[model samples]
Target: MAKNNTRVRWVSIGLTALIIIAGIITAFLQAQADIEAVNTKADAIVKTSEVMKIEGCLPSRANGNNITRIDTRLDSMQREQRTAFKEILRRLPNE
Candidate 1:
C-alpha cells in the first residue's frame, strides 16, 4: 500500500510539472505571436509611408497642364458669351 501511494504521488507530481511547463510554453508562444503582429503592423505602416512619398500631395505635371488648359478654355467661353450679350443689347431698340 505504501508503494502504491508513493507511485501515485510521483505520477501526480509529474503531471503537475508537465502542466506548469505547458503553461510556460503557451505564454511564450503568445508573446511571440504578439511580437510578430506588431512587426507586421510596422511593416505595413512603412509600406504605406513609402507609397505616400511616391505619390506625393500635389498634382502631377500632366494633371496640372490639363487644369490650365481647362481654365483657358473656360475663359475663352466667358469672353465669347460677353460679346454675344453686347451684340444683342445693341440690336434692341432704345425705350
Candidate 2:
C-alpha cells in the first residue's frame, strides 16, 4: 500500500508538471499570434496611408495652390499654341 501511494503521488506530480508546461506553451503561442495580428494591422494601416497620400487625400494648401498654378499655365500655353497656329494658317497662300 505504501509503495502504491508513492507511485501515485509521483504520477500525479508528473501530470501536474506536464499540464503546467502545456499551459505555458499555449500562452506563448497565443501571444505570438496576437503579435502577428497586430503587425498585420499595422502594415495594413501603413499601406492605407500610403494609398491615401498617393491619391492626394491629404493635400496641403501650398500643394493645392501649386497644382492650380500649373493648370492655369497649361491652359495659357494651349491658348497661345492655338493662336499661333491660326496666325500661321492665315498667313499661308491659298491654292
**What does candidate 1's lDDT look like per residue over 45-72, in tens digits?**
9999999877774456547646677789
Indicate the residue-level lDDT of 25 in model 1.
Answer: 100
User: Cα miss at 35, model 1 (Å)?
Assistant: 0.8
Q: Candidate 2 lDDT, tens digit per residue, 1-95? A: 99999999999999999999999999999999999999999999999989988776446554764677778999999999999999999999999
Model 2 bad stretches (over 4 Å): 57-63, 66-95
Displacement of residue 60 (Cα, Å) in model 1 is: 10
lDDT of each: 0.92, 0.92
Clashes of 1: 0
TM-score each candidate.
0.56, 0.60
Q: How many clashing residue pairs appear in each of the predictions shown? A: 0, 0
TM-score of 2: 0.60
